[model samples]
Target: MPQGSSKKRERQYEHVKDSAKKRGASESRAKEIAARTVNKERARSGESKQASKTSTQDKKSASQRGGERSHSGSQGPTKDQLYAEAKKRNIEGRSSMNKQQLAKALGR
Candidate 1:
């Protein structure tokens, strides 16, 4: 819900916000996630002028981008995140492991 977002981006933000809320994210956190998601998508699609360098160059989806940065803060890595890292590292048996197991295996 930041300023200067297009109508399309605003709709995307609302959808993402609701989805995050359904997944049990706090209100403010949901808003933040939604805003970031919409902004990143806008950047990827060249719909926004305020694109990040990484956002412009990265060919991956928003989910993939989020996974890469999920561990940067206090929150633990998500399953998708651990899987992505494991995939990058070419770790064996990663596909079969759950989030906790993957975290343990990755020494996170």
Candidate 2:
């Protein structure tokens, strides 16, 4: 890290310490904030990963719902429908994506 950036972080830490002291924060409370601010970043990232897993599960259920609603003449969504789903989720270049590409883009 650059010297200036390191100093900036030290300043931020000092500010947090001062604020905690001024507000009569418990040691535990201060430690909790400290953990969330720095040491727990990885834990927060893990939470986002779990959220993406739930999203994948949700997509699976939604696709199944479409499957259940198909009439005799009406078929389940085709590749185009999957691409549309990708577009709805703001996937990049969804129009150009095939079914497998759409699925990968949607997951990410």
Q: List, residue by residue over 8-67, the lDDT tens digit for candidate 1.
A: 888888999999999999999999999888777887888887798987888777566777
Residue 62, candidate 1: alpha-carbon lDDT: 52
lDDT of 2: 0.55
- Per-residue lDDT for 11-49 in model 2, tens only? 555566567767888877765554344322222334232
Q: What is the alpha-carbon lDDT of model 1 when measured against the actual structure?
A: 0.85
Per model, state how many residue pairs clash: 0, 0
Query: Model 1, which residues run further than 4 Å from truth?
Result: 62-108
Strongest candidate by lDDT: 1
lDDT of each: 0.85, 0.55
